[model samples]
Target: MTSTIGVTDRRALAAAQSSPPPRSSAASRRVTPPRDALSVEPSVVDELLLVCGVIGTTVSDTDTPDRIVPVADCLNWLQDLQRALRRDDDQYRPISLLMAQWKIVPQKLLPLVDSCRYDTDLVLTVAKILVILTKPLAESTERAGKLPIETKTKTTEA
Candidate 1:
């Protein structure tokens, strides 16, 4: 899990991320953030990606632990991301495509859910992610489909 930083590294690794302002911050402040404050990063997208990666990897492995504590923490982290995603902010709109690309489907989480059935918080967080992902995605997320294929097939009579 440390290989791909998640909520645990939120503070230490926060300095390097340079995500664009969400629609909520369309009027971004001009004042420069203090250097120490750089570690106080705003975007949770990378954390979300990491959480998904962790869950996906754990699901694929046959010898995964009986209870993945990190996944529980990931659920908490995802809850924060869900809150950010639920806001009526266009800047965060691009994240929908990310969620789709990462395959954050309800079924994708069943393995962990099965392991954590006793934990109500984890169950509810999974439900929240499922509910949020089921909604119609923002138009910008369409780019998630073909972003890798530029499709520039032009032949100049070679």
Candidate 2:
């Protein structure tokens, strides 16, 4: 009887060992971030456009007129929107407006590129428009970054 009990215990132990360990609820509930995680937030748009502005400024400085044009246009657009929203300190409205504009304008603008046979004139025009469109988000993102993380965190926490 002792030997039988020992065999049964060993079998149970072996089976337990072969099976995977149970996961904690937190571990089991782990979620994969969406592929477009950045796009999920309105501020993310501003941040991205801020980076675009930085890139555009760099390109413009480097005298890469062709490449700079597109990047510059994106930057300018973001900056303009930022100015408009901050004009009377009426923030939050610009994000909704800019996002709507981007969705609509890109559809019309993209066709112009192909329609013009991707010529220098057309490229420049697109770049100009993009610069104008990007200005607002860029400035807002810049200002937002200027605030200390601790301040933002504390404000949100409270």
Candidate 3:
């Protein structure tokens, strides 16, 4: 009986040592490291820029010939959006409205959502931009049902 107990304890210890530690929930898991910049293809960057241009042109207030906005302008707009999101502003509404009006579906917006399996810095960059653009919309929608109209107007005015 003593020998059997010893063998059982040894087996349990060996199994514990051999197995990996249990993982946390998916929400608590660490994000995968972004791909290196040099490995990103130029065509991927260009495609991302093209999508940005389409969105920028759709949202721009100034007169753009043929409604074709420059890629650089789109990049600047993205940077502005990033800053606004950091400040927790409502700048997301314009971009959201533009996307709706232009019928730019998720499939056309950020290729990263569909192609993240391909490791690339461009994909990561686009993914971050999309997150910034969509987060405010998500938060606002959540609050819309809970907040009174007066409070909503006051928050927006601020």
Best of the candidates, TM-score: 1
Candidate 2: stretches off by over 4 Å: 1-9, 17-31, 34-43, 47-109, 120-155
Candidate lDDT scores, in order, read 0.53, 0.44, 0.43
Residue 128, model 2: Cα distance from true site in angstroms: 18
Tens-digit lDDT track of model 1 for 1-158: 35545665775556546654456552453233232221212344555555566653443356765444444366666567677557523423445545555666643576667777887887888778667766664433343333532123334995
**TM-scores of all candidate predictions against the true structure:** 0.45, 0.26, 0.29
Q: Which residue pairs in candidate 1 have backbone atoms (N, alpha carbon, C) closer than 3 angstroms, thus clashing?
A: 23-91
Candidate 3 lDDT over 53-103, as tens digits, reads 443332234564223322434444445444433443252243334333444
- Model 2, 1-158: lDDT tens per residue? 47988999999999999999998775575443332321224454555345333423212345433223344354345445345434422222333344444463444445445444456754565555555445564434444333322111112554
Q: List clash counts for every candidate, in order.
A: 1, 23, 0
Better of 1 and 3 by TM-score: 1
